[model samples]
Target: MKAMLPESVRATGADILLGNTYHLMLRPTAERIARLGGLHGFMNWDRPILTDSGGFQVMSLADLRKLTEEGVSFKSHIDGSKHMLSPERSMEIQRLLGSDIVMCFDECPALPAERAQIAESMRLSMRWAQRSRDAFGDRPGHALFGIQQGGLEQDLRAESAEALRGIGFDGYAIGGLAVGEGQEAMFGCLDYAPDQLPSDKPRYLMGVGKPDDIVGAVKRGVDMMDCVLPSRSGRTGQAWTRRGPVAIKNARHADDPRPLDETCTCPACTGYSRAYLHHVFRAGEMISGMLLTWHNLHYFQELMSGMRAAIASGTFEAWEAEFHAQRALGDIERV
Candidate 1:
């Protein structure tokens, strides 16, 4: 994945990529990576990398995890080794990794919980945000971003945003949605959630979704987002295009001579046909993943570039209309 950075990512105009604090800490250990000259040297990619604070992973991936006022303690899923992640520790780890963008350590409560429970969780996250800020101190070029967490409650979201603003951060992330909240409910929260943050700073939507989800979020004023959808979906034989998803594993593509998308200039579309992609995917060839992942990443960057250009030229609405209209066409009517 790191090897693909130059052509597949940077060439396509993506300047930043997200790194998982939890997974990195577990595998090579922060100390090892730092000893080897930090993440850039370790990964051989000099671009900006945003590191999450490990709070969400502790809640989701760790085994026998225990949350407390100070932090959380858990056993690693890789091994039964014990570990702890507090706001201070999280800050230290990101600093050790030499991340360009460090996220504040904050609790993310799963949705469908009672309003009272969500409120309590959001309040706790606010306190942690302050601690994260304090622990982060002053890094010359590096930035620390605060996270706003409040289920779907508008009042709670406003309150959380106020708390983050009071503490102050280089950027703000709207968290706690996309856990299980459907797109409509998530968009409803976004309607007011992003507006609550400082408009001057970048507004990042964490774990935000598909092409449509990204389009909607950008339209609603979110400046940054991160998700595993494109890469993961590509590995699973799913391709995202202007016309929507195309499942390459489906029988319909087995003998199709056309490219995945006629307008796409990526290697997948330019060098291979739908039939070749389907054959390789069905045969479990590794290139199947590489080509598809490249195409997906290229497509996402194209989408971002289009949005940025549209917004700069004061024609975002027209660009967005075309985006949806293309999707409405629906994958070239099944080949």
Candidate 2:
């Protein structure tokens, strides 16, 4: 986060930043952060910060995690310490972090589970979601969001959404779909997920996605999303561009005297050329990752801006078509 955002905040201007609850709880401990004066003061980011419940990591990253009706017990991925995470504990951590938006702790089961398994997980998460709300109490500016987890099945998703609404939350998130399901399947699930929730409240999609994925999600009525793809891809020398994903370290870019994207105004696009970026990437220079991360984040912000505008104008369909068409034209020299 420090590597990616400080420069971009001044260069491109970002409004809000997202934080990972799983990583923070493991390292700094939310109480320690609160002692230091909340996440905003600790990180020096004054804008809004959204923190997820550690529920997802408990299921995904732990080696020997056990789930039950009460909560989850798992060995820490970092130090092998046994820990139990309940909805109440998750709420306490987010409160300690002083996040603007907090997510309800929900069990995100792996996709392709049996119907019975999915139903069981959804029921447990709904129960936990209620516990999270009860634990959160209330704050004037702070908002709690509930996560809907039912895999890709429409009926289950609807049931989960209905349960979350009944419990009441400031927002709702479509969870459990991005965990290995392809875009087609994920989109199919999304077709019904957002509709299940109230239209007035914000709709969030957790741990989602590539450039095209974001566009498709917004078009399907999702209002916000968070993903680590930009920063993760940047470390590996991949650049997401208007024309599609670009491999910055590829040999073909060794002598190409062009920016990553002609229309982009990121430092990588405005100040540096492909040849220089390629050299930096191959040499493992620190600046390569910083610049590429900034470019990818800037592109995401741009995509959001376009979608917001299109939605306001009621031309989202046309914009989505053009987005796909542009990505279809692969590697081409802009002469």
Candidate 3:
């Protein structure tokens, strides 16, 4: 996490960072972080930090995780220790971390679930959302976001949204779409998901996606998104550009003299050539990941900024058209 940010700081010039409640809780424990002067001091990030409730990770990564009416029980992925994560426990963990934005604990089941299973999951999450809200009590300057999970079914999503609206939250997140579902299906879901929730609240999309995916989601009314793809792909030699993604290790770029993307203002684009980037990545140089990660994150932030500006100016349609056109053509050689 520390390594991912310094490059991001240089590229996108982001002021704040996100922390994972589940990851931190597994290692240092939120209590320890609070005793050490809260997450801000513990992580050395003075700016606002948003912590996820760990629901996704608990279901996705942990083995032997059992779900019941009370909560989820599982063995720690880091260690073999047993633990239970309930709504109350999740709220206490976030509170201890002193996060500026906290997410409500909700179940996120894998896609293609039976209608009965999806309905049950949605109802359980709603019940847990109430518990999370109740446990959090009241805290000023701190925000709680509720996750709406109903798979790709429109009716289920609406039901989840209605339940969340009744419970009340600072923000609403559209969950359970980006998990192996194609862009078209995801977009179809997003078409109604944002409108189903309150317009005044910020809408977040979880575990989303490629550069094009981000642009499309934003155009469809998503305000925020999170993904490990950019950073993870950077470490593996993938560079995401406005044109498209370029696998840096491809032999075609072995002697290319131009930067990754001429439109990119990232240090890697302005300061380094594709040939050099390819060489570093092929040679297993540590700086390769740092540089490419910086570029990818910069690209993502630029997309976000462009969308925000377009929305404010009411030119999102035109901007989205250009966004789609740019990616339609593969990255051309920069002379």
Model 3: worst 10 consecutive residues (lDDT sum):
2-11
Greater lDDT among 1 and 3 belongs to: 1
Best prediction by lDDT? 1
Better of 2 and 3 by TM-score: 2
C-alpha lDDT score of every prediction, in listed order = 0.91, 0.88, 0.88
| 1-335 per-residue lDDT for model 3 (tens digits) | 53365434644756556789888898899989999999988866777888899898898954569999899998888777888999999999999999999999999988777889989999999999999999988899999999999999999999999999999999999988887778899999998999998999999998888887887788778888888887888899999888888999998888998999987888899999999999999999999998888888888778878888988999999998998899899878645
lDDT score for residue 51 of model 1: 98
Which residue window of length 10 is worst by lDDT in model 1?
A: 1-10
Clashes of 3: 0
lDDT score of residue 323 within candidate 1: 98
TM-score for candidate 1: 0.97
TM-score on alpha carbons, each prediction: 0.97, 0.97, 0.95
Candidate 2 wrongly placed segments (more than 4 Å): 5-7, 333-335
lDDT of 1 by residue, 145-198 (tens): 999988999999999999999999999999998999899999999999999999
Q: Residue 248 in model 1: shift from native, Å?
A: 0.2
- Name the regions of candidate 3 deviating beyond 4 angstroms: 5-11, 333-335
